[model samples]
Target: MFDVAGLWHGFQIAATPVNLMWGLIGCALGTAVGVLPGLGPAATIALLLPISMKMGSPVTAIILMSGIFYGAMYGGSTTSILLKIPGEAASVVTCIDGYEMAKSGRAGAALGVAAIGSFIAGTIGLIGLTMMAPPLAEAALKFGPSEYFSLTVLGLLLATYLTGESALKGLTMAIVGLILGCMGLDPLSGAVRFDFGVADLQSNLDFVTLAMGLFGVGEILYSLEKSGTASILTTRIENVFPKLADLTRSGWSMVRGSVIGFLVGILPGGGAVLSSLISYAVEKKASKHPEEFGHGAIEGVAGPESANNAAASSSFIPLLTLGIPGNASTAMIFAALLIHGITPGPFLLKEHADVFWGVVASMYIGNVMLLILNLPLIGIWVQLLRVPYSFLAPLIMVLTLVGVYSVNNNVFDIWVMLVMGVFGYVARKLKFDLGPLLLAFVLGPIMERSLRQALLMSNGDGSVFFTRPISGSLMAIAIAFVLYNLWAARKKNRAARAVASSEAAK
Candidate 1:
């Protein structure tokens, strides 16, 4: 049975006036950041880390930040549906049918379905969080260094699979991220690995600086490369509510998406982006009119949008329960918890029940709040797209600069942002996925630490990784995935060659 008393206590804390206010502010700021072309949830949370530290209790700070996290997931779709540009990786699927819907003059319906579906998925995710978290936390207590290392390996393999186009490219980017992660002081020896004697290099590349530069500044530069200005100028606001037929069509799609998203979200380093892609693929495969997917299919818009948001919400489980962050935003949230002197792990449920349950409760409230706020204000958000690029672009640039500078009060971060922006543009042009890179950056340290610990525990034996049952199983799965992926690639190449020969014969 659910613990009613614990939930009641959580509601009491989350309902406080100050906490509620922070949640609202976070939601609004997150929405604004998401609406902007370049900024993402990770950048926004990292930028605000300094401010969050100076503010209220850990629970309240997290409440505020969580609002921003989930809100951005919701808000990213708005721009994607309105413009062809995706606000973030998680919103990429939204652009497929969402923009098509806008072009077909059903933008209102698309937006409506997105908001409603997100709300429903968010609620379901919270329910899963509330019920499943404690048991998972208990289970995580048994995870040793070997198990953790295996998990990280699995996570990297999953990243490779999720990366579009080529697994080799994803592996290359992940290796690059791991190398970049090694620039700082070694955790075990306290020795510098890649520092060139510069004081900033001594502390290593800041995650905030790297992320802000790559996603924020880099995105802006890419946008500048496009010829001519673009703006959201459409004034046709139809009914904000989904029609009865539209609801009937998308109801099951939403359920399927939520289930898949929640399960994927539980995996370390898998979150909204992977969930959205998987949901879209599943929806397309199951659709009665699969051909309609890229041409304004309602299921395309509804399914992926819901999946992304639900995945965003459920990702908190590992972070709060096992002290393992599944994504960059969750990593930032973990940083916030550490800053506030809270160590999240197996004991958190018993020791910090208020914080855990309060966060869960707030998510429920936040979902309801988002629906109420977004549905009626869809017109306002659409109008926001009408702002001239000349004005909006520079403002985004300035915000990016300020956000980078705010972290550690360092001007070096601004320079890093500029370099990263250029690199990001190049990567985008080369069709490299940034998702794998970001995940690698976040998981690199954990993987390193876990591997070292496991080796030490086994007297420096390399076979320790395969000695444990759980660890061995995970590694076996990862190996299978790699082999399968390679086999599939070869098969695809052969098929393509056969097609070319047939064309030549014709």
Candidate 2:
């Protein structure tokens, strides 16, 4: 049950003129960060941490910081839909069908659905936070190493659905990603693994660098070869909002994404990126027209966008209730709280009800503001599609390079990005899917660490995953899904063979 009295008090604090202005400012900055590739919310918050200390009021500072966090979730889809560049790691899945929709002149619909879906999910997730934060945080604590390992395994298996038709190619890319993920020092032992004698390689590859290279620079290179102009202009802009048909198609997807994102976000390490990927996989698997997934499916844009936003909202649960930041962005917030002489934990609600409830109240307001702000901006973003690729290409390359370098201020990252961009271009030409590679790269470290921890805890027992109840259940589900996919592929192959035989007889 929700505390109506406490929530009302929260609204009082959030509705003050000073807090509102800061919230708006945070929202604007977050949107800018999301529109630009490579700059992430975590870095932005960390940059602003010193300024937050001067604010004097912890509640106001937190409201501003929280605003930026969720607002980025609303803005990330813009670049993905318009330019096929993922504005944030969580927005990577949006690039698949969102870019396709842009090419088909349905950019407006995709943007509209993403914004609306985000609003819906944000609202739903906040409500869940208000009503179920304590219980959910406790549930999240139940996820041990075995459970986390099983979960990552399930996520890896789901990566096959995100790529080329051939499971072999998807698995190969996943394995390659795992290898790439292992390029730095080992987690358990500080020994270097695959640094290739480079000092920079000793520190793991930056995900922002990799993402900007693979999507932004790679897209530019591919466009230079494939088409000299923007393909989107071939199809005229239809509307700035989603049509009734699109809304109908995406309604249930938004709801489902909200549920999945909130639940996943409660668990440690399950941040917006992971939730978005899981949401995309769920939508693809649930769709009646599964073949249409990678090709302008509105559900694809709607579900993942909704999910990431929901995850953004729900991710605060661990930080607030358990004093454990689930992701880097939340870790920054945890630091900010500490700087203000406020410790977040079980007694936080009793000791600092104002901070807890004030943040939650502001999130509700931020979601509304984000929806309004993002909707009008869709038309402006769509205009970029009118620019010729020849003229736009250099600008994109500069932004990609700048964004990649900004993350770590390292020139070596730029060189690495250039190499990865060339690799991405060559991979695209070879009909290879980059989605599984990125997904696996993100999950690989978590999976390895969890597997090692679980094994250590179980005295090197390999069957420990099957022995634990939660891990056992998740592992069983993964096995069943894999078997089902194999059976489906074999059935399809047999049907194709029969058709070939019939044509020969004819």
Number of the top lDDT candidate: 1
Query: Number of clashes in model 1?
Result: 1
Give the clash count for model 2: 0
lDDT for model 2: 0.79
* Cα lDDT, all candidates: 0.81, 0.79
- Candidate 1, residues 245-268, lDDT tens digits: the string is 998999888998898889898876
Q: For model 1, where is the 10-residue window of minimal lDDT? A: 226-235
The TM-scores of all predictions, comma-separated, are 0.90, 0.63
User: What are the clashing pairs of model 2?
Assistant: none
Where does model 2 exceed 4 Å of error? Answer: 1-118, 125-134, 162-166, 228-363, 374-382
Question: Model 1 misses residue 231 by how many Å?
Answer: 3.7
